[model samples]
Target: MASGPSDTRVLVVTTGGDAAGEESDVASSLSAHLPGQTVVRSSSTAAEYLRELGPTVDCVVAVGADADVVWTISETDPSIPLVVYGEEVLYTHVDAVIPSTASIDDLVARVQTEVSESRETNHLEEVNAKLTALSRYAKQITGCETVHDVCDRTVEATHDALDFDFCVLAFVEGDQIVPCCSTLPMDAERPIDLGEGVAGRTLETGEPQVVADMQSDPDATFKEREFRSVVSVPVGDRGVLQVVADEADAYDEQDVEFLEILAGYTNEALARLERETALRDERDRFHAFFEALPVPVAYVEAERSGEASVREINAAYERTFPQAADALGEDAADAFPTTGERRLVSDRLRDADPADQQIERSVREAGVEPFTVVLVPLERIGLSASGYLVYVPGTVPSDETRTGYSS
Candidate 1:
């Protein structure tokens, strides 16, 4: 589990014309018990002292101060814990109220407890905010279509969402890890051999590695020697993601966990893109086969209106029916001129298994001879689209078939 801030700062203020001597004694007592904490004694009014150093003070201890001063500090920065060491008062805004008669040990313990609780609460809120931003970045990563796009978005999220000082996204290419994108400038982009550096080891082992002091760690290697700390995580089997800092021991376990979560998102996005690219290549090969066929073929797909339309027509389809060159995007039923032939084609389009329905039509009505029209459902070829391939054999002109298509 991640811990809170290492050091706590407490401000002791005197109000209501009280002497500074009592405040000094209270600060000294608190300092003796608190150890490793700062105790500031201020003789000025609570409001003035708060305005000067409000941001740094984690907790406040008002000595001989009244309820009004307590309210001022609470209203000025309600997040800062406040402890009142004077006459017990019923102030709902104050965190703790200890009477002057109470032992100095009691006051010291109260201040320490309040400061620890405040720091813990602040740390939780910061972590929650970073996780929320990371979730939004995950959505953006899903929208990326290529590996480069995903890597670029990952680097952007590392800087904007994780707030890392430096970051690099590298992919494993053959026996080397190549830099895809980086937050810092790279004078010479070079590849690192697998199992050579921290990132290489991460990619080789398929695990996350965090080095608090890269200079002292034998497994760590730096392209820029200024980076002293590093946290690297594997991006599935494709690559590695690394975040670096200048100061030693800059990152903790929580930082490693956060980077791992981001790397998981990147891995999922890359896998999705790979699947889509393969599907696109398959579709392209099928289209090439459809075009090279010597028979007339028309690709028809269902539109938003639930009507089938001519999405694409092959060269032989245009040569057989020259009028179809301008028929792309037209309704499938419109391809036939006769009412009976149009009805037959439209009925096949609505059938769940159109490939089994074979119909012969006479194109003489459209100034051509009779031929057999074969409806091959696109789903037969592993396509997800609700469409069919209209195949007409022996329809192409042998001497000269104009090679033209509309898509």
Candidate 2:
């Protein structure tokens, strides 16, 4: 079995030979080079010893012993590596079959290096899994439409993923942990004092802090002995976002680094969410204005041929022209033929002199109020129209002849 980084236990099974034989010497050398684990020599014969020492042995540092005996022992426990002293080695399962004459330091060094590399590979696989989870969280945070949504998700995701007993995300409002999101169930929200806690120190200095065992740690200020692990990672650029988690000695340097990376991406997403919210508010305000306008407004689309297409007409348009829907996107002149003493509105549209154009209308239908129609260029009304904002009868025509600079 592969042991931990600080330990490598090997069973030395040599022939019943001299005390100063290569196997006995290799056991002493292995003990000196490898830090932990005992290098023991089997007192029984190799055949008898192989049956006794099974999975407990990580490797077998074999010295000059019978090939039949060695092969008999090695085949029984293939997991245990065999580093031969001065024997022709023919085994596929051994990690490295070394000559027994090789220096003990070299063997120990190889074992230590392999053990460490395996641990690092495992840690990296764990990091990759964590990164995949954090990326999903990032997408959810940015998808939200409210600022509170961002804050709530940040605290919840951190708490659940890290297995922390307590978690509090605070915004840095000039040196205070303004409690924005937390997992304190059934408690009223309160701001944590910046100068009073470990989290506060990180915010004030813009550096991360972790107390592995809070009770024994000198830097830890909180007297709550139940909580052992404390980690504080700053979220924003230059300490603007703050995330602090408290567990039972679970948070390490690697965990802190992972949280910091999560925070950086979260900050950008929240910032964008804030801007979208503000823009939506502005659009809502315009909607209110569009509904309450005093004058009739028609959003008109102008064709290149100078024909007016009424895209939208307000409530006032229904009172002005009872047949407004039929008139929409239809030739304006065809809908209302020009009466005497009035120039054709279509003729003025063809000339493209929308601002100065005015036509008098007399409705033959009884009880109808005579009105004068004025056309202001639809483009000027924010609805680029060969179209015009036709006003009520009392409205005066704004000057169209005035010269102005075009942007």
Candidate 3:
């Protein structure tokens, strides 16, 4: 067992006759140099004292110890480093091979350095584990689709990765930041305003903020909520994600940085969801207008070859040409009465480029009345295809043409 950073234990073994005679002086020098440390001395030939104390000792000092004693120390515990004092010697287990003439200060410095290094190594391992958990959480949140899923995952992942007791993900709705997900129960009826608390301040400035001691800080109004420490990270311009701890000064700069990384992942996921929602709404509006149009209309998937297939036909199209409904999914050219009319329409609407706007072509379908068709490429309205919106307007050809679509 090794002592903690605050304290250390050093075991001194005197092997030869010369070392045994100077054991008291050597032990005193060691104790004086290492403050807040316990020093033990052993003179037994078999080094039984060293054996008994090896488990608890942090560092071992051999004063002119013979080969047998050194070998015993090495076999018992190779990890507990030995600082051999005497003429130049080499041992696999010995940490430092200093001459007998070397001062006590040299030995004290070596022991303290080794003990401090051991503690630091342990600390780094713990930090590495925490970072691994953070990475795993980032990967888990990528599959989330909805705003609710993003917010819930953000709060849950933070708790799982950092062990933060309380966490919340809020979104900017109108003039206020509203809590969408939280580890604790929230009052849905109440809204948290921007700039009201640490989280609010972070949202307003688009910066990460930390309140190390919420209860004791004069600037903090959130102390009424009873949290002692708080770290708030902004999620783009969208909102803020905050974590609260019960203990005062629980969070530091490292905690704030980790939360910032989490917020970055959350921001990207939320932006994608928002775009999808907007597109869905736009598609719904387009479907309503497509159904309500009074004119004979055929919405086709336009091709670079200027040939289009009728994806959907309105009621007016069915009334005008009842055969057109049964002819759904067929090329618009085949649905027309004459191949000449198909060539004419295709030529006028050339390549179905939305920038070319609307094109008109007149056609006489055998005995049927001659009518003018207006072809407007649906690509202008953000449809998937370089398609056209075909409608016969008032049975006449006109110079006036509509260029842009308004939603």
Best by TM-score: 1
Alpha carbon lDDT of each predicted model = 0.73, 0.58, 0.68
Question: Model 3, range 309-389, lDDT digits (tens) per residue?
Answer: 677878777766646676577776786555443553455444454322223332225334434555655533333343445
TM-score each candidate.
0.83, 0.57, 0.62
Candidate 1: misplaced stretches above 4 Å? Answer: 1-6, 16-19, 43-49, 89-92, 185-189, 303-305, 336-354, 364-372, 379-384, 392-407
Candidate 1 clashes: the total is 0
Candidate 1 local accuracy as lDDT? 0.73
Separately for all candidates shown, the number of backbone clashes (residues 3 or more apart, or on different chains) is 0, 2, 0
Q: In candidate 3, how many Å is residue 289 off?
A: 0.7
Judging by lDDT, tell me the better candidate of 2 and 3. Answer: 3
Ranking of models by lDDT: 1, 3, 2
Clashing pairs in 3: none
